[model samples]
Target: MIPITTVKYPVNEFFQTIQGEGLYTGTPALFLRLQGCPVGCPWCDTKHTWEKSDNARVSAEAMLAKTAPSEAWAEMSAVEILNVIEAQGFTAKHIVITGGEPAMYDLMPLGQELEQHGYQLQIETSGTFPLHVTENTWVTVSPKLDMPGGYLVRPDCMQRADEVKYPVAMEKHIDALDLLLKNCPPRQDTIIALQPISQRPRATELAMQVCIERNWRLSVQMHKYLNIE
Candidate 1:
């Protein structure tokens, strides 16, 4: 087994951007996107991150230099990643750990290291894999149901989420979420938000209607609208 100190995360991309969704919308954040996910969501925008190609591994510098999205990834230990962040002089103290299903690997090491330096952590995950993040990490479990990967959302993950940001495109999607909510209730104060699939008009209208009726929040993929990274 790899030693804890040497534990490296296969990173797809890292950058500072405005958080475009969930309870922390509009927050200035540093996004550290990890590579690899088997929980296939058909509408996933970062399909380049779905596979960690062995031949695509490159130096951290080369990975960061990437201007276009591709399968290229770099393995960086907690310390190395921290150094890069510091070197870039990033102003965002709130770091978002996302994927390609980031929870597929243990995040505690990265979390602990980041937190030690006074950065708050948040993870966006499909509540399928077992979560192994810092206790203080804000968990956002966007339940993925009936995906091609054949993974089931974990009750523990739903219960632990600080926010449940479910993606919706139809009445059936809402129905599925209702069932999940009933079966795996989140914390009493857990924020529930609906994100329209790819800003489709029907999906957005459905999401807005449901959010209005249920007092849920709406996540409009602000980055997409703003045409920002």
Candidate 2:
């Protein structure tokens, strides 16, 4: 159990509309994009998030002001954060805790507070950190190979992931995915989604075949193809 006494000063970005992909697609939710990711996926869309120095260290109030005022957000204490969410007119039960790898911080307090309020927590991670999350929280692990900081694949990440979302560009990515999959438990409930590298037809086709051969699922980046951010 994470100590609630620990203060959570999330160097967070803004809240947005519905998530673009994953199990929470189409559902309206708040996006907490915490800055600082070292995992370098060649095709990472939010490359801005890659460098922590690139983002301004703004107060949560300043961040919230950019959105609807009635929509609540505050540079808050964990307890204060819950109050802000209640203040927000947001009725959506889903809350996406994403990042520059949100796992970099201990999320037990945040997850516990949100879950207490009946909000379903979902974390989008790179399968690097030993995730501090609730049992019910959905973990989407998009593994990157040979990234900066010399972070190799860790088994704890693959094993904990409820879904394995891979970004496919060339055959090499499949090799990387297979390497990671070798460590995971052979559970039928584990969802494997193959998203093509930048909507490339050839990459998509390759991914489709891989999926069909292994009975894996293809996760098209519907938002990217539609040109929605």
Candidate 3:
């Protein structure tokens, strides 16, 4: 494993694309997907990123060559990541640091560097680990419940989040979110969004009803709808 102090991260992939979900949906952004996660959601789309191994230690070029899901990753220092962004000529000012659980590693250094360079940073996490990003970073916590991984959402993680984007697949999912909201009253600025799982019709219907009843917002996966990554 790469040392956290070295400012090196195990990267699964990086690409410039539209923000797929949550509060920043439809916005042009650069996605930095880090590798490794143990909090397994049964419907997880990126199962390939669940483990880290020697196969993940590849060159940056080889990492970018991947056009499909693979258990491959590359270690990249913050400076090297910035170079790649510049080389790619990404014009988006927003940088989304997502992962197999981004909170599993410290993100303060990278967040600080991105802020210094005038880039806004956002982190998408599962809210199972303590957050360590800059205050300016937008933290989106999509809490996983009753998943294969037995990890519970940490209250501290919820309190630190700018938004709680919950995936709704059934009534039980909404009930879990309700219990979570009651347990952790979010900050005044915290946005609560309900995203339908896999864009299922039943899930979408449930989300819409709940959002209306609770006066929360709906976050459809626009990227998935548009057939984009």
Give the candidate number with the greatest TM-score.
1
TM-score of each: 0.97, 0.85, 0.96
Candidate rank order under lDDT: 1, 3, 2
RMSD of each: 1.3, 3.9, 2.1
Give the per-residue lDDT of model 2 (tens digit) for 8-124: 645455454767776666778777777667777665666656555523555666766664222222344557666666677667778888867788877888888778878888898
Better of 1 and 2 by TM-score: 1
Q: Per-residue lDDT of 15-67 in model 1, one digit per residue for the tens?
A: 99999999888999999999999998898998999988899999999999999
Q: What clash pairs does model 2 have? A: none
Model 3 lDDT vs. the true structure? 0.89
lDDT of each: 0.93, 0.73, 0.89
Alpha carbon deviation, residue 36, candidate 1 (Å): 0.4
- Which model, 2 or 3, shows the larger lDDT? 3
| Candidate 1 lowest-lDDT run of ten | 1-10
Candidate rank order under TM-score: 1, 3, 2
Q: Under the 3 Å rule for N, CA and C atoms, how many clashes does model 1 have?
A: 0
Candidate 3 on 126-194: residue-level lDDT in tens? 999999999899999998877788998888988998999999989998888989989976787899999
**Stretches of candidate 2 exceeding 4 Å from the true structure:** 1-6, 51-55, 66-75, 184-188
